[model samples]
Target chain A: MTNAAADTTPAIEAFNLTKVYGSGNTEVVAMKDVSLTVARGEVVALLGPSGAGKSTLLTAIGLINPPTAGRIVIGGQPVMEADHALVDLRAFRRQHLGFIFQKSNLIPFLSAVENVQVALEINDVLPRPARSRAMELLDYLGVADRANNLPDALSGGQQQRVAVARALANEPSLILADEPTAALDSERGRQVMELFRKVAHERGAAVMVVTHDHRSLDVFDRHFEMEDGRLKNGTERNIEQ
Target chain B: MNLATKDIRHNFGRFALTTVGIGLLLMIVMGMGGIYRGLIREATLLVEKIGADLWLVQGSTRGPFAEISRVPANLEDRARAVPGVAGARRFVSHTIQREHRGRPLRMVVQGLSWPEDRGAWIPLVAGRPLRQAHFETIADRSLGLPLGEKLKLGKDVYEVVGLTKGMVGSGGDGLCFFTVSDAVSIQFDVPGEGVRLERQARRARAEGQDIGRLQPLLLERAAGPASGIPALAPPQVSAVMVTLQPGADAAQVAATFATWPDIKVYSTQQQINLLLAGMVDKARRQLGLFRVLLIIISTIIMALIIYTLTLDKIHDIAMLKLMGARNGIIVGLILQQALLIGALGYGLAYWLGTFAFPKFPRLVVIETPDLLSLAAIVLGISVLSSLLGIWKAMSVEPNKVLS
Candidate 1:
């Protein structure tokens, strides 16, 4: 999927984003003046070495951590303009964005399908419709067979697939995944990447994932490499599938 | 956070176990509270149930009926003369051991005189009140008296015509209600054979006659209540039961007795205070201490439980924080869980406390206000204990999950 072929809007934008932890001599700059935009229906992979601020940038854009200085726009809406600083971030995140972590992180008590359904439930969705939506997401992710399996009972790759379905449950325009394939093997990692691409292209969700694994580079529509708190395009971005 | 339902379902075992622990602790708190109420009831049981408003007793006596009170029989008449005094009667209570069915039964013989028809105190719970008042007695049900049995007191036998309930004395003795005259006779009536045999033996020693022959003769000579008896008569009575006249206060009427100077006086309330309430004051205090300690132990245990359960969710909580969940949502989740647990514990406490005491060893009184207050107190404790962990969870950072 090409960014130009996608919807006429930016799915996620971060301008002049900076995250500084601590103060004075002990201050650590996690992200410094970082800016990026991913268009709707495009999947972008953030590539970086360890400690290159890949997670910091991802978290800032994900709204888990507000940037110390800068503005963030999600789904073409200026959600963080420094004016709504006191606004509720958790409710905003629940309504507008989704998250996937290295581990499946599905609540251990609920079944694979219920894990996705709960995300919608927390947003005050009616339980009946919530179940229907959860099942649809699970079916789309190609793991409808294991919907009843708990997190511990499912395979690692299957768990990650369910986690992806959970992220897609609310139909958010942007799905932020951090090291989404870190726990999967090369083959399973490719499958998960392809799923994210499908969600980006078919569901019109702009997907961004932080990955250390280079084996799955062919799956992303765009790629940027982060080094020492800054992002620059890699030769891999120009590489054809 | 999408975690409330998940956290609860995810650890069903831990949740059930925690609920059970809270339930047990709640039961203990309820039991202690019930026992305390029971103590209050035990302290006031006999007096409150005796069905009288004023007690006329000898002056300066205030317990073992309200304070230690013993008054002359004439005090009842004098009490009736006082203004606002409608009626007064005499009641003498004395403890005596008698043989019934080859078993020694210790009984308190209560002498009820005219105008003091306290026989109502012993309702025909088993039989009827003493109809004749001369040869019949009414007794508490616990006395183990049959419907028609003779109660042998000294030389004569008093028939049981009625039985009553809830008339326990301060010393836990069963009361036997008899007529005033009957009680007086029993107080002094000597065993017929024993008195005569002693006298005959003494005379034989002094008369130079054969001991067996003299004994028979003396026994024949002393035939009835009229023979060989000094007849000093039984002690009249120790106290009287007085009722205040309509519209007249018993305390004021009792104050009138101060001028009489012949005897001491006690109002009904004073008698209840001295005899029943005062008798059980020590027990009430002991039970009160027990209740306080149990509540402290339960609260501490409940607090530890809620805290431990909260700690078990540390990892999940950290993850929720990392996933863009707010502190308020986290706090609400923990608090909802805590309060629900508290509510369940309180429900169990109320049911067990209110229904469990009557069947207990001693009567336990569970008042409505006490129940309501305890519920509020337990709920407050639950909220307070949960706050400890809520604060800790609030201080938990999202960075903890990322690592």
Candidate 2:
């Protein structure tokens, strides 16, 4: 396990995570023996080159793509092993985890605040309370001024910030960020990276971000690298199968 | 629910287009229903107004309304004497065309037995009944007849003494009632001026002893005064109206008359089915075909709308899946929009169907059951049409986001 996650029990843990696409002779391993953990209140960086299977590992950890043969434990509960079984995938995702993507990916129809509120509402929060909570997040992201704006009206940085707020709306324990800064410039990208660090430290959430750019690595509590379907330099993060 | 509302708001133009398409189809469906009901409404007014218990016609034919059938005038006396009989009235029904204010009112003339006879069956709205033996009439308001209005028949002008309501024939022509003798005269009356002119023309030609003068003279000397009046009733008519005495068996009475030679007996139900219930049934069936066609067009239009709307958001759907939104959530959004359009279109259709067209010359009696059942059927089809979008949304893969 990585040192930070190993300091106490991890909020997220993977054991020998592997993903193979297609079957038999035509098969290609998108990820092989990926193992990492991020403890509560820690922010970790996953570094890789283009086509280095960063997305596959993130999808696996996000509980969307079940690993071909591996074990996943989230919040001290066994979730997927060999084949995926994560209680109800929809409920587990809605209640336990958050996700951010390279693009803002906010639903274009919803206003910035409503985009975040939808997450809380879907989890059955009362409307007034959900709206208040969404407003708090918009304020925290420094996008409260544009809270009423639709996605089409917001600047790129503002949209991505709203997406981050949406991911945090349900008070999820683990946040997975896949290339979350790829769409921003160095200054805005560093600001978004620092926000993840602040969220992890202040809210006690475990954050794992996959990125190709190394310019914002200072915001991460720890860093690991992946190459050729495996982690290369991070010995403490190597999975035991 | 939130996603559905959001999607519709974001694509307001698309949703409005869908509603317009559905509205056009709904308009056609409602129109067909109105046309079919109009025909039935008109054709039933006569029989419904008369309120008879049983109908008697020639043994081999159905008549007085549906066809031509005549029997002896003495048969009314015979029919009134049958056991369980209250009274019988002789009614002579035939069509007449006359000019009123330069427009044609094709009327069905009913020759009533007398005031104490079946005259009670017809309601007179104004003025007096036929006081004279002939040439006085009670006309339906559908003929646009006002009090004391005169209709030109050949060379004579007959004054409208009374007005009737809702009396019509199987052909949807309104009815005018007169004394049996009056009806006979109106049916047989030859204009005196025309006869005189013809006689003079024939004499001037001097071809022979003129045929017109010869026939009237020959017809008059050897016969009664009414005999020369071509308007008099024939020795017989088509049918008698039968009213039952208390606790009488209508079925048995009808059965008793069933075996009579050259005559047919019908209970009110048989008469309704053969004569009135099915007046425009074939036409209604055709209008029903048009309704089906309109609904089919609506189904196709709805399918295209939902499909296009789904395609517009292929990226959003993939992103939602990537964000761990359930397939159910995505599907609910599309289906809710479809049901919204259905509810709107049907609401407008029912409102217009019930209230808009009754004032037209043709009556549109939209039955309540038809309105309700059609609404439900249209909504069900709308939901089915919506499933195509839901299915397409469900199949999108989050892996596309990774790519």
Candidate 3:
């Protein structure tokens, strides 16, 4: 598929994705024939207990760990089929994908603006424009005032905001967030969840978040729960209150 | 903002400390090289400074430095008569230990055939060269002999007339110049008791033994020094130093002298090579070994430091890899850090060598080409040392960040 198809296609499509760890007697299936689709401007939540393969499915969709048997398309570009990368995954990921981890995972030495700018810089943006774009993203995320602060200097919520700004710096079509607000308090967590919702709605980017907290379910357009490495159908649960 | 510089700035104290440690090691390496150069300089200084085109010594021996060489003093005239030779002088060199104010001082006494020749070659720093032939001597300043001070050698006393700087033998001993007649007397003169014992022994051995014409010869040999026992055969010299006329080929003169059965002749260049390869070879090898060992130690230390630094940043490296940074970028970061450390260490070492080497007890000769070569070696070592860190960084799995 060409880039033109990306305009009208869903932001992510995974068909019968399978992931296996080890082999022979030690063989374990992490994900089994998982199929999922997320539309543009959609916010989705993945809920699961430990070892439920939520991380596995998340990593698989993030193009970090390719599935054993699967077909994945992101932004109308055929990215991976089975174990082979149909595209230059690293370059494709750099151009079309963004990630947010449980912790901010910011480069400790870089200031907030620099951390965000690094993402744009990796995408071949010049320093001046990348700096401006980083500042714009920081302002969009309400962390512009902390742009010069290093990650250590920022509060947990502020650091997460800066991380969000970093994820959006490249204008990626899809953002994969794995427990992005787990370390924050309930109010801070809700605020971060709402930020994800705003990002997906305002920027027309697909956002998938893996979280154990049910308090912010309403912030997502659809909810997913996993069990035994299998993804269940989405439930329209609105529990934002 | 270079990543390597940022990292170094982040841990400035530790980075500076490591650089200083490596700098000290490099300083020692450079000092060893300087000492080697100094040895070469001291070994060939007198040979070059003597201003002689060729050296004629006893056959079957390398002169002065390698073995004892003695030729008849009359050979000086024969060497001067050679086709290309402009002048020739009898040169006598011997080491002797003497007492000065209750302190023992070992000195190399050089005997010049013509006293006036001292002014032509020997560099006097404080006083005039030897003006009179009998008891006047020019001493190397390193001996601490004051001008006009009296020094006793054997039974004769001489006054120091001048002081020369850096006029040392191959063994680094200071040299004192005297007239050939005085040196020969001090070196070859036997004590009065030994002459009496030899005369008595000769009288006892000749009693009623030679019943023929040998009786006159035996009676004459029994005579003492006052009786002139063959006049002591004129005084032998260690070597004849020859100076060539303008445009004279030293090789041609040396070749002509080589045909003589009892004399070995060498050009000045050949003598320098002999000194360097023969006399200074062991010291040079020892210094070369030290330099090699220091280089190895430096390489190992740098490798360990870089490896430890890389290990400390494994988390950051994983994150970078996860963020789509290529292996080349990470490798470049480590290499840049290594090169920075090398440059800083070398700079510190160069500074230290410049200020510290002169204060050392021995001569340390630093040359520009040596420093340039050291820099190239340090760069090569930096690249080689960073390989360990580069390998570690490259092996870091991007998936490690997920954990």
Model 1 Cα lDDT, one tens digit per residue, B239-334: 655665567766677677667765666555666556435546776677667767866776777677767777777766776665455577678777
Q: Return whichever of 1 and 3 wins on lDDT.
A: 3
Candidates sorted by DockQ, best first: 3, 2, 1
- Scored against the true structure, residue B371 in model 1 reaches a CA lDDT of 73
Measured by TM-score, how close is model 2 to the native structure? 0.84
lDDT of 3: 0.86
Tens digits of lDDT, candidate 1, A1-241: 3343356889988888888889999999887888888888778999999989999988888776778888998777787763245446767777767788898777676799888887777677888999988898888788899999888999999899888888877777888899988888888988998888888888788889999888888888888888888878534352266
Deviation of model 1 at A124, angstroms: 3.3
Instruction: For each candidate in turn, give its C-alpha RMSD to the true structure in angstroms.
Output: 6.1, 5.3, 3.6
The digit string of per-residue lDDT tens for model 3 on A68-139 reads: 999999977788999899987777777888889988888876889988987887777888999999999899
- In angstroms, the error of model 3 at B204 is 7.1
The candidate with the higher TM-score, 2 or 3, is: 3
**lDDT of each residue in B1-403, candidate 3, tens digit only:** 3568778877789899999999999999999999888888888887888888889989988886678888998998898788978889888888888688899888888887774375556778988877787888999988889999998887789999889987877777888989888888778767778868877776676564763236776566655453465645676898989989898876777789999999888878888888888868989998999899999999999999999999988877877776677667688889999999999999999998889998775678989999999999999999999999999999887667777
Candidate 1, residue A129: how far the Cα is off, in Å: 2.4
Model 3's number of clashes is: 0
